[model samples]
Target: MIRLKAFPILAAALVASLALTACGKDAAPAGPKLALDAPLPETIPAGTKLVIGDPTTQRVVELNGWDKDLPFQIEWAQISGGPAVTEAFHAKALDVGSAANIPPIHAIWVGIPVKMIAVRLRKDHVNFPLFELGIAPKAGIKSLADLRGKKIAYSPGQVQGEVVLRTLAAVGLTQKDVTLVELPSTGDVYPNALVSGLVDVAPLGAGVATKRYLDNYARDGAQVLRHPPYRDDLTNLYVRAETLHDPAKAAALRAYVKLWARAVEWQATHKAEWRDAYYVRQEGLSPEDAEFVVRAAGDPVIPRDWTEAIGMQQSSIDFLAKEGGQKRFDAAEIFDRRFEALAAEAAPKIAVGPAPAQTEGKTNP
Candidate 1:
């Protein structure tokens, strides 16, 4: 995990530069520095490789036959989430990774300069929100107003922390009004925390996690309440600054970003195949859980313009800074816009419905 005080400033940057220098020494000769608006390199030199940490898109590319014809090579790393990706970037072990919006911002704070190169969101983001509040059994919390004095799980390093903050903001409650049980929301931590009464509330994901929490604990008065409508489904691909300094690697990243966008569209259109291949077969989720998970994802929408996205990020940065007493920076500095149009241009346009139709009777809580 990317612990708040663990990574030091200068050492982190020095290690990242050293790692890139070592990698460059063993690869094809380095090319000239890539300018901000310079055209992308026409041809990637031989031996250009990217260490990709996106497990979902890695599976999508393989299943859809999208990896067989790539000009550059990819080393897929089974890593996701902010903490893992941030740690890898600190060690210079990963070139690019997939995560929510917070990781890139947190990366900047931890002295590892990074940029979000690609972005994705749900077509109907509010209805298809990624997180919901899970109330503990016997907690007697029925609404946001009831949370004034409850213990809530908060992980400032991940997206869940931001959800909790945003949730409180929706109901006009601040952290001072509630007890924030500092915890990590990894794997089954949040669900387990809720069930064990370690916290009265935590943000349970809208898919299998929420489904199983209700199935196992609703009998004991456990309840799941939908958080206020907000845009929380921000998925992004981010890279370390040192990696982008390499022109050859940057060109390779440009190609991967295009494919990454196309992969999102493919996954949205081929939901059944994706659910079976990724959730069921790879992640060991039951068919029902996999189906609910896929439906909850709604449709993928990669925007051609990132102006709105950057605005959202800037708001988040401002909010987090005030809450954590940390210095704030312009959110636009964290995005590399050269690849902004690649995803939208490469993805095939698909008609989007109102929202993912909820599962009929099995579970919608």
Candidate 2:
């Protein structure tokens, strides 16, 4: 979250950046940075189709009416995680992809024309992490140092992967110190991988990590190696550069952004309905465990400030790129603000639910 104190300065800087005019009087028109209203073509061409790549178990937009009453039809693709979605973007398979902060950062570094259209902040990121580094009981790993020469499962181009990297770097270890086991970025697989001893340690998914932690505790005992709170890098809604150029598609995206934010607002505010429908029914997760996952997810926010998010991502890129042997690039260029107007327009209207601050990281059954 953008600290309330920093809003004034960030807002002014963003306005000033947006006000820049083209390459200058002598150069070709630069075009508007983003169109909040008028002059943005509003019609969806007949039979226009949009493919949305979902990152995990629930896509809240589909749960609510956001995917309904659309000017165009939406084709949903269950893309598992950020790294996988980056590959999908390369193939031009995703019009809108939901991913963590790492995907676009790595994509932009590799020259994939992608940009974040919307961002959702987890308020609980300030209190508890949505991810954890889990180790098997037999591994006998008591601390970060013990991780050396151990096999750690991770999916590159994902948030928890970055966390693992950061954890290694902090302890003066490099990728060479341990065997890095690369896995598909799916929430379903991490727990089993660890239990079966396929990998000594792994970063488990948000709900899976918590559920497995409880399950293993009762059955054979599992240990959470680490869970970092206040790691504010977030899940993002992104689009391919090609989609941003089509006038009809762009307009539809604007509406989609607003409706998606509305969906987030509804989901965050109505925990029971969301958990029951999404977690218990659809996902087959137990209710008590579902409640923990919901609270841990925090509130979904269509952030008003891009400055904070961009800075956090840039820092991560710098750290990972140097260590992972990737070329350096600017992070500010990775976000598309064309939908900001509609995003802000939909934010304040979500009046039904408790605010992000009220929950304090626990959910009621």
The whole-model C-alpha lDDT of candidate 2 against the native structure comes to: 0.64
Off by over 4 Å in 2: 1-40, 55-62, 216-218, 228-232, 349-365
Cα lDDT over the full model 1: 0.78
Off by over 4 Å in 1: 1-29, 350-365
Model 1 Cα lDDT, one tens digit per residue, 1-365: 21353222223454455456546432433556665445556478888788888987888898878888899988887667777777777777788889888888888877888888888878888788888899999788978889999999987767788899889988999888999987767678888998898999999888878888998999999999988777788889999876776778878988998889878888878889889988899889899888988998788788776777888898889988888776899998887877666677678474222322321111101
Residue-level lDDT tens digits of model 2 in 282-317: 878899888988877766655565566777877987
RMSD after Cα superposition, model 2: 11.6
Clash total of candidate 1: 0
Cα deviation at 84, candidate 1, in Å, is 0.9
Candidate 1, TM-score vs. the true structure?
Answer: 0.86
